[model samples]
Target: MRVSMDLELKDIPGQLVLALKPVSEFKGNLISVVHHHEKKTPRGKIPVHLVFEIKPDHLDNIISLLEESGISVVSVDEKRYLEHGAVILIGHIVHTDIKDTIDKVDNTGYAEIVDLNLSMPRVNRPSSASLKIDAVSKQHMSAAIELLKSIAKEKDLLVIEPIGIN
Candidate 1:
């Protein structure tokens, strides 16, 4: 079986090698790797295109191991429906339990918080953050966003949904 994966790796020494090491553990033969060092992906990480050939039965295990290792596999095969989205959460983000809100999205399993940027004016003052979420499908992405929105409403925060590019 042939598999193509797009991954984001840190731009540090040995990061590429570390990303490729999982292939060998899964009995996969490395075919090609296109590493871009000059340009970073939207998520501000090095983008790597990797191709490998492995036994069909080992595919799932290999994917699981990659995800478990904190490697973001942006795409696999030809499926292009994977959703990427961002939202802005306004109000007392830090005081209202930021970690708990992040945990809610992370615990869903269908989505992940890929990036966060927070700004606070003063202690007990209003704060806001931009959260980037990645999910398997549009529905799951929307569900995750809605979950955050609900939590924000309950905590007296404001959720600005689908902060898309024009």
Candidate 2:
């Protein structure tokens, strides 16, 4: 799973390394790290934002190690969406209520529209959009695409799904 964590480290030498050691010890793949050395929290601790991928079961152990090392964990967010797929939609996207279309997918709880790029060549002409969808698994991705296809049909839009989506 992908995890995002907000950590507060004491403003001292080697504190950043001390905080990240636990994550590395647990074999977590580091995705990103943002260290706010110039910015201090109200408590005077340095703030760090970390994004990494690790086994879900190892999260607690990492947290314990960080606390033991004097690192304060502010928050943690886990993203369960592990599968991604893309589709091209050609239609009157803006006119069809883009928010409603995206809401339908997100409302399912298992999937969401992560990215969208729309092109409008001329006013009142057909528009094209590329959408990136993320879900917990490939099955959920397929279901989301199928739902999008059904929505497109009702809206008189064209859904150009990626090849071999099945």
Candidate 3:
């Protein structure tokens, strides 16, 4: 199976090596790597595009190891979702737990959070965030959205579902 990965790494020395070491350790054959040092991501990390080939069964193991090593696997899958959706959540995001929200979406296995933006004006003020979620099918996407809504309701937060395209 051919795998393409987009990674964000620190700019310091040894960071690239740290990212690539997992490929060999997991028995993945590296095809190519495109590191864009000239451009940095919004998070201030360098962006790297890499391609590799590995046995289908080893894919999940490799991904788990990468994440365990503190590398964020933004996206990984054979099927692409043609449909996309975005939603907004208003609450005390930090107190409510952002990692817990991400874990819920990731644990579902059918959908994943592709992007997130959070803002808070003050400790007492409500925080708002926009989440971009991707799924293999519309039904799965709706299910994920429903799960998010449930979480919001439980936390006493407001959830704005995707009503139209931005």
Candidate 4:
């Protein structure tokens, strides 16, 4: 998995090395490190941004080691989305409660709708919607799409799923 971390270091020298030593000790593959030496946070600490790939189990240890070394971790973002897919629905999307549909997918936790484009030619005509979903893995993406299909059936909508999505 890939992780992005924002850290704050003291203004003293060798802080960057101290901050990154933990990641290396934990066997994380360093992707990039942006040390903002010229900039300082309101707390008078330098900000550093780091991107790395590491085993899921080792992430916590890396953070712990960094904190133990006096590196302040401002934020940690784990990039979990590894699969993406898009589907189209043709029906009375707005009248059928679009928000409810979106909520159902997002509540799944493993998947969520990231982008949506709606096309309503006329008020009385059937509406069309293009939805882009992101999920942690291919299985989760498939399950999310299946859930969408079931919702479309309940709303009397026509689903146009992409070929080879599975």
What lDDT does the true structure give each of the candidates?
A: 0.83, 0.93, 0.81, 0.91
lDDT at 125, model 4: 100
Candidate 1 per-residue C-alpha lDDT over 119-161 given as tens digits, one digit per residue, 9 for 90 to 100: 9978878998999998756777889988988999889999998
Candidate 4 Cα lDDT to native: 0.91
Sorted on TM-score, best first, the list reads: 4, 2, 1, 3
Lowest-lDDT window of 10 residues in candidate 4? 79-88
Off by over 4 Å in 1: 1-81, 163-166
Q: Name the regions of candidate 3 deviating beyond 4 angstroms.
A: 1-77, 164-166
- Segments in model 4 whose C-alpha atoms lie over 4 Å from true places: 4-62, 65-77
lDDT of 2 by residue, 9-96 (tens): 9988999899889999999999999999899998999999999988778999999999998899999999888899999999999999
Ranking by lDDT: 2, 4, 1, 3
Using all chains and alpha carbons, the TM-scores for the candidates as numbered come to 0.53, 0.56, 0.52, 0.61
Best by lDDT: 2
Give the higher-TM-score candidate: 2 or 4.
4
Query: Model 2: clashing residue pairs?
Result: none
Residues 42-88, model 3: lDDT tens digits: 88888888888766677788778777877777766443453468889
